[model samples]
Target: MHSTNAPASRILVTGVGANPGFGLTRSLTRLGHTVIAADARPHAPGFLLPTVIPQVIPLAADPQYSDVLEKVCRDLAVDAVVAGIEHDLVPLVDMRPRLKATGVRVWLPDAESVHACIDKAAFHAVLTANGIPCPRTWLPEQIDEIPDGVELVVKPARGHGAQGVHFVNRREHARVLCELVPAALVQERLYGHEFTADCLVDRDGVASVILRRRDLVKAGLAAVSTTFDDPVVRDLVVRTLNAVRARGVCCVQGFVSDDGAVAITELNMRIAGGFPLTEAAGADLVGQMVNGLFGLPVDHGRLTYETGKVLTNYVETLAVGDAEAPQRNGHSRPVASPAVQVRPDARRNASPFLYGAETAAVGRVLRSGQYGHTDVTEEFEQRVARFLGVPDAVAVASGTAALHTALLAAGIGPGDEVIVPSLTFCATIQAILATGATPRFVDIDPATLCVTDTLIMDAVTDSTAAVVPVLFGGRAVDLSAVRDELQERGIAVVEDAAHAFGSRTPDGRRVGATGALTCFSFGPIKNLTCGQGGMVIPRSPQEADRVRRMRLLGVVQSQDERANTTTYRVDGFGLRYQLSGINAAIGLAQLDHFATTANERRRLWRAYRDALTGLDGITLVDVGEDATPHLCQVLVPDRDKVFAALRGQGIGVGVHYPPNHLQPAFATWHRGTLPATEQVGEQILSLPFHQHLTDNDIEHVVSVLAAALDASGGTS
Candidate 1:
C-alpha cells in the first residue's frame, strides 16, 4: 500500500470493458498505484480490477452521477480518477465536494466551458446568444417547434451520449418526440462532415492540441469512427477551445458548414471516445489528468495533435440462459431467456433504466477514497420512499436490513408478535426475527397473493405489536383496512413493499404509503435492483434516525454530531447494514427512470391480462381497480408442466414464492397451518419480466404458455 501520509500518486481506470478501455487500464496499471476497474459486462478487457462501480457515471449528464465515482475512489483507496469519455466528465465535476472532501482528486473541465457538453439546447442557446456559428435551433416548447422547411434533429436538454436523438424532415416525428421529452431542443440538421477535437489544458490555462479526428459515425453513433487531422479542423478546434473557459481535457464536435464556416455542435468535457488515439499519439492523458488534479507534476515534450489512427469496437451477444440474471423492469422480476419475459415496466427492453444520477453523485462522495471504506449498497430507502411517495429515504445493505430496521424503529422486539404473511420472501420474516420478534404467518388471499385484512384480524393477539403486509408480483393486498385496524389496536404497521414497487392499492394509494415503516428491496431480483440492497422509510424522525444510525453501524446521527470525535458506540445495538456507495450509485441512476420504467410495466401487465383473461384453469391475480401490477403473475393448472415446458424452450420463469412455513427456520414462528399460502406456492408462476425484452418476446411468451397449457389439458 502507498504511505498513509504521502500524496496519492495513483490514478483510477474504470469501465474496463474490452480493448476499448484496455489502453487506459494498461497505462494506469503500469503507473504502480492500485488501478481498479468496474463494469457490469464480464467480458470487459484489460488488467481490470473489475467490480461493479466506475470512476464516472452518467457518462455525461450531471443531473448527478458523480456520487458513484466518488464512492469508488473512497472505497478503493484511489488517489485520482480519469473519465475516459465525454459522458464521464460533468458528473465528476459536479461531485467536486464529495471527491475533495475525501481528499481524492478529479480533474473537471470548467463548467462554463463544458456547458455545451451534454445540453444541446444550452449549447445552442449559449452559441446563439454569443453570435457563435450555430445551427438553427429552438426549444421545442414553442408552438409547433419543428423546423417548417428544413429537416430538423431533436435532442434532450441534458443526456448522456445521445440516447434519444432523432432526425426527421417531417413535422410529425418532431411533434411525437416533443411529447416524449418535454423541453427538448430542435436543431436544423447541418448536412456536412462531422469532426471532433481532443484537447488538454494545464492548471496554468495553457491549452494543448492533442488530436482532431474526422468523425465517421452511422445513424448518429452506433458504427465505428475514423479520425483525420487537417488545417481547417485545427483552426476550428483552437477557436472552439478559446471560446470556452475550460482548463482541462475537452473534445469539441463540429461540422464544416456548407457555407465553409465551421458550425460547432457540442463540447465534451472529458476525453472523448477518441482519447485512446491521444495515448496512441504519445500524450498520456490519464496519467496527465491524475497529476494535474492532485497538484502532482509530470514532464512531457511539446504536445502535437496526432493523426491517422484506426480503432474498432464490437458487442458480443452472451446468452444468460439460466444463470440468475439480475433485474429488469419496474419490479424485480426474473429474466426470461427464450420467449422474452419482459417485466411490466420495461418498455422496449432497451437496457433497463438505471438509477437516477442523483444517487450516483452522492454515492461518489461517500465511496471515493481510502480514508473511508468503500460503502456500496442497495437503495434501501430511496426505492421505498419513491414507491410510496414518502419524503424520507435511507438505503441499507439488504432487504433483511430493511425489515430489521423497520421492526426496530417500530419498537418490535423480544416477545413482540409481528403478524407477517407466510407467503412473502424470507428476508421479510428474517428481518423481523432479527429484531427479536416472532413472525405470525397469516393466511394469504388467493386473489391478491398477499396477506388479507381478515387474516390479520384472525391472527391478532394481545402480543401483536405490528403487522407486515407482504406483496408479490408487484401486486398488493388491500392493507388500508388492516392498517386502520392495527392503528386502533395500537399496533404498528411495517409494509414489506419489496415486490410491490410499481403497485398501487385500490382508491389510488400505493402499498407502503400508509405504513408506519415501509421497507423495499432492490436486490438483483427485486424491483429497481443493484445486485443486493434494501431500504426502510420510517414515518417519524426518531424512527428515521434509528434506521439511519443502525445502517451506519449504529452511529448517533449525522457526521455533524460526530465530527472532530474519534469513536462511537451503539446506544441501542445495530449491525453493519449501510448501503455501498457504488451500489447506491447504480440505484441512483435506476430510480430516476423509475416512473418511465413503471409505466412500461403497466403496459405489459395490460397485454398479459388481455391475452389470458378468458383462460380457464389459470387465474391471473387481480390488481384490483386500485392496484397497478408490477409483475404479471397467475395461478395455472398443471403449473409444473407449464414451467418445465417453458424452461425446456430455454425460457426462465419463477415461482413468486414458497410459503415461509415450509422453511425450517419458520417452523415455530407460526406453527399454525396456512393452507392458502401453501396452495398458491405450488401454483403461482412468475413469467419472465423486465425492460430488456421486446414486445415480440412477450407475444412469444404468451403463445408458448397458451400452447403448454393446452398440452397439459387446460383450456384458454
Candidate 2:
C-alpha cells in the first residue's frame, strides 16, 4: 500500500545471452512485466524466450553504444533498465542522466561502487582498508614478492565468467602468466566451501540476504545449490556490502575455511546466475525487487525463505536445425537464404573488410537527417582522443587533410620548411605543398626505415619550421629522443602516424599520446578504417581549436553551431575538409574493435616472420617489439619480377612507395642525397597482410615466393 502499485512496466535487460540476463528475463515475464532482451550478437539464445522482445545492440566498447541505447529507450518507451552482465554495467551507469531525462528508471549502485566490484584489485583494496577478511592479492608487478610453493590464482583483474583464470603453485608460473594476462592480479588460493548471498538493499540502506551453498559448479555457473541459514555468514555478507558501498541487487561470494573463518572472494553488482533457488526456497525476491525499483517500501515478511530446499540446473536443447513450414491457416512466410562463404585464396587483392557495427553505424547516420559534420563526428573525435591519451582530436577528410590542418595550426607557411623522410608516401609531400612550405627530404635509417635523430639534426636550418617523422608500416620513430634534440630549438615535431593507429612505444605508451602533433589515417588499407577518414591530435588546446576551425572552411564556431542548431560567421582561411557524419560513424564502430584488430595484425605478421626465417634471397623488415605492423614488408632481389610472380599465383603483393624525392612533382624540391632510401625503394615489397588471412594462406604465400626466388636464380 506504499503507492508503488502500477500497471505492468516495460523493462530492458542487457547481456540476455548470459545466464543472469536470460534467467532474469524469464522471471520478469512470469511477474507480468514486458521484457526487452538485448545482446551484441544477433542470434543470442535469449531472443527465443517466449513473451520477450529481442534487440541487437552494439557492444559496450563501441563509441556509439550509449547513443544507440538512448535511442532504443526513447523509441520503445522503456520504463526501466537493468544490467545483467558486468560489461554493460559501466556504460549504463554512465548513461544515468540520459535515461532519467526519458523517465526510464534504473536501479544501480553509484559509479565508484560499481567499479570497485567489477575491478577485483579495487575490491580487495576496499575490503582490506575496511578491516574485512579477504584473501591476499598482488598486482602483476608484485609477482616477485610472492613466496615459492604457495598456491596462487592468476587472473585478469577486470575479468568475468572465470575467463583467463589460471591456477598455479609456483611463483615462476605466475610470473610467466603475468606477461600474458592483461591487467593481471595474483591472489593466494583459498580452499573451503563456497557460498553465494543473494542480496537486495532498499533505498533506505536496509538489506535482505538469502544464503545458498553452491553444491556443484561448472564453468563458473552454479549447477546445483541448496538454501541455508547461518547468522555468522549473513552478518559478514552485510558488512562486506557496506565496505564496498553496494546498493540495489547484487551477489557476494566467499569461502568458509576449516578454521570456521569466512574470507571474501569477490562481489558482483548483478543478480547471481543461480538466483532462482532463492525464490524456490519460498522468498519473494524478484517481486520485492520490482517494488523497490518503483520506490516502494519492501515487504520484509515476504523476504523470509525456508532452509534445506535444493535447486539443480541442467542443460537442455531449446533449438535444433533450421526448418521452414507453412502456417496451417494458409499464410506463407519468406525464408532468407544463408550467406555464401568465400575462401581467402579466391580474393586476388589486399583484403579490406567491414563488420556489422560499421553497417549499423552508417545506417544510423542516414536516418538521423544531419549528414554534415555533427554530433557523431565529435563523439568519434572524443573516442580517438581517449584511445590515444591526448587532450583533443580533430577528424578530417583524409590523411592529407590531417597533416594540412596540423601544419596550418602550427603557424607554418611560405617562408618555413618541414623536414620529411624520403621513404614515404606522396601524401606527406602533398600536405607540405598545401601549407605553401618547402619540403626538406632526408635519408632514413636502413633498419628502422624512419628518420633518425642524426638525420633530423643534420637537416635542421634556421628556416626549419617542423620535423615530419613518418611512422612507416607502424614502426614508431624515437619521438622522445627527437623531441629532446628539437624542442629546445623551437621546432615542432609533427608525427606522420598514418600507419600506426594502435602502435605503442617501448615504455607501453601509445604513439599519439605524446609528441607536439600527430596524425592518423583511416584509409582502406590502414589498421582501423572509417571507410575514409583521418584524425589529428594536438598537444595544446589552442592548436586543437585552430585545427577544428580549419577543417570546416574557417567558419568560426561551425561545429558548435551544428550541434546547437544555430548559425555561425565565417572567419579566417580554412577548407572543406571536415569528415562527414556517415564516415565518422563507421570510424566510431571500428574503434570499438581496434585493440582486437591490432593484436590480430601483429599475430599474423609474427607468423610470417617465423615461417620465412632463413629463406634465401629474402630479408624481413626488422619491426621493433614496440611496433604494431600495418603491412609485412620484406626486401627481395628482383622485386618487380617477384611481385608479378606472386600476383600470378593469386598471392597479392605490391611496392609500398617509389622514393618521394624521385617523383616528378617532388623532384624540384629535393635537397639531400638519400642513399638508404633509394636503395630500400628498389628492394621493398609489401605482402598481403590483414586480420582475415589464415595460417594456411601465409604458408601458401611463402611457398610461392620461394619458388619464384629459385626460378629467378637469385641467391639460392
Candidate 3:
C-alpha cells in the first residue's frame, strides 16, 4: 500500500534477491522513497529496479560483512536498514553499536531474543516454557526416544526457507536423515491446516497480527492465500511474540487442527514472503512499521484488514541474462609488497598510491631525528634529478611554493606580468600572484587544455617578464616554435609541470628535462606524493643554488655547514619553503616503485578509452600517447546534470576546473572573453582515474555514465 502522508526516507533493503526483499524494494520505491537494494549476488533481480542504488555485499557469515555494510551505509548516508531474510538477523543484532555510530537505524530485538526465534530448538524451548502449545522437538542425540509410529520432520536446527527438511515415519529413517543434515533436529510432524501471521510489534510490547491461511503451498511459500481473523490463532501469535520479546516487523507460522487446537512451529524476525496479501486486504503494515522504525508510534487501528481478500502468487521471470563474472585484464592485479597496504581511493578525482616501503622509510627518518634539509632530502633531490635526466632538482614545501620561488628567481616582480592559461588549477594562478606579478590569463587549446605556442605568442607584451605554460592533465605544452622568440624578448619560460611529473615532451625528453624551469607537485593526491612536498628542475647550476638557498630562508650555508659554525647567512629574499626530511623519505620510497605506478595509470586510462568508444555526445579530452595521463576527462553536453546524476549513483565524477579568469580572485586581471576556455569549462567532466581501479571497475563506471547521459537527455 502507498502511504502519501509518510515521510520519504533513504532506506537500505538487504537480501534483495529473495521475493520478500524484492517486493519490499519495489513497494518502497512506489511510495516515493529512495532505496539502496543490496544482495550477496551480483546479478540479483532487485538491482534492476528503477531509481534504486544497487550494491553487492559479502554474505552474512563473512567476517567482512559488517565492515562493508557499515562503509556502504556511511558512504550513501542511509537512514535505516530492513532485512528481508533471516540469515542477517544475528549479524545485524551484533553490529548494532557499530552501525549506530555510523548513524544507520536497525530495529531488532536483543541478541538472545533473536537467537531464540531463529534457532528452532531454542524456539521450542522458549514456547514450551511460556505454556504455549508447540510441536514436540528433540536433538539429534535424542532421536531414538521418539514413538515408533509417529511421523517425524528432520531439519537443520538453525536453517530457514525449508532447506534440508525431510519427512519419515520410522525412527531408523529419522536417525539416518539426521546424520545427513547439519545440526539436525527432529520434530513430530503435525497434520492440520497451515497459516502464517503477518505481524508488527510496537515498542510497548503490543502486537497487531493479520492472519492468512496457506490455501495452496509450494516450496514452503504460500502460492495462494486469503486473509481471515480468528481469535484463537491471533491470541497464540501474540503470546509467541511477547514470549520472544519481538520488535519491528516479524512473522509467525503454525498449524490449526480441525478440532481448534493451535500449535506454533516457526517465528522469523523478518517480513514474510506473502506480506503483500495483508496489504491488499487494507492493512498499512509496511507504513506503520516504518513509523515504528523511525521511533514514531505504530497505529494499530491502521493494521485492520478485510477477511475475504485473496492473493495468488506465480513464479514469473524478473530478469534473464548472464550470471558469470566479468573477465579481468592481466595487468589489473594488486601491487605486490612485503606488507599489505590499503586499497586506493577510487571515489576521489585523484589520489596517491603507496607501496609498503613508504611506512618503513618514514619510520627510519623519524628515528634519525633530523627533519630539516638533511642528507635524506638531498638524496631525494638527486634521485629525482637522475630520473628526469636533469642536472639538478630542488625540493620544496609544495608545488605552489616551487612556483613562487622559481618565479622570484626568474626576476618577476610587482611591475611585471606572467602569461598563464585560464583553464588550469587556481593554485597555478595564485603561485604567480605570490611573486607579486599579475597574471595575464590566456585561453587554452580546448583539446588538451594547454596553452599553445600561438596563444602564448599572441598574449605577450612588453611587461611580459615570464610565461608559465601549464602542463594540464599531464600533457606537456610544446612551446618550441616561440621558444627562441620569447628568449630574444627576455621572457623566461617557467613550466607549471605539477600534473606532468612522469610525462614526456614531444622531442622524447622528459617534461622536466626540456630545459625550461619546471615545477612538480608531490602533494597528497598527486601522481607521486611526498605526503606534502614539491620539486623544481632548474636550468643551470647557478639557478639550482639560488632556489636551494631561497627554500632555506635565503641562507647561504647548508644545514651541515651551519652546524659547524655559530650561525647561518641570510643572503637574499626567501621564505621557509624547505621540504622536510620525513617527506623526502616518503618520496624516496615512492621513487623505487615509480615504474609500476606509471604503468598502472597508463593501463587504467586505456581501459577507459576502450570502454567509452562509439558513445554519442561524449568527446574524450585527448592526452597524447607519450604522456603519463594524470586525469581522465570527457566533454559532454549538460555536464552539471550528468555530474549530479553520476554522483547520486556514487560514481565520484568531478569538474577539474571552472575557468580561473571568471573567478572573482582573478577578476581584476581578466583581459577579455576566453571563448574556448569558457565553453570547455561547462563541458568537461573528470571521471575517477587512479592506479587502484581494475577493468571491472572501469566497466561499471562507463555503464553508469551511459545511463546518466541518457537520463539527462544528453545522448539524444
lDDT of each: 0.64, 0.82, 0.86
TM-score of each model, paired residue for residue:
0.53, 0.55, 0.55
Put down candidate 2 lDDT per residue, 419-504, tens digits, no spaces.
Answer: 99988889998999989999999998877788888889988999999999999989888757668768788788888999998998
For candidate 2, the clash count comes to: 0
Supply candidate 3's per-residue lDDT for 101.
89
* TM-score of candidate 1 to 2 decimals: 0.53
Candidate 2, run of 10 with poorest lDDT: 328-337
**Which digits, one per residue and each the tens of the lDDT, describe model 1 over residues 1-716?**
11121232445654455333544554443333334454434324432232112222333343434555665565444567666544455566677777778877777756665666566777777667666686887676552754468888777767645567887887777877878875577778887777766677777666766644455565444244555666766765666666666666667777876676777788766666556666666566655655666665523343453556655544434233454454443211233444333223223211333322444355565556521213333343444465568787777787788888888888889999988888877878887888888888888888877777778899899999998887666666666656776788889888787776666766677666654577878777555765577777779777888888887767675554566678756676777887776667666555654655566566657766777766667888776544445567788878899988887865667776888888988887657678888888888888777643434456677777888888988664
Q: List the residue pairs that clash in candidate 2.
A: none
- For model 3, residues 1-716, the per-residue Cα lDDT tens digits are 33634466668999988988988887776554567788887657776665466677888998888888887787555789999878888899999999888888889999999999989999999999999999999998897788788999999999897789999999999899988999999999998889999999999988999999999989988999999889989999999999999999999999999898999999999999899999999888888888888888899999999998999998766444444333332212222222322234345566666654677799999999888888999999999999998889999999999999899888888999999999888999998988889999999888889899999999999999999998988998999989999999999999998888899887789999998999999998788889999999988888889898899878999888888999778989889999999999999978876765676677778888988998788999888887888899999999999999888887878898999999999999998899999999999999998765545567888998999999988895
| The best candidate in terms of lDDT | 3
Between candidates 1 and 2, the one scoring higher on TM-score is 2
Models ranked on lDDT = 3, 2, 1
Pairing residues by index, what is the TM-score of model 2?
A: 0.55
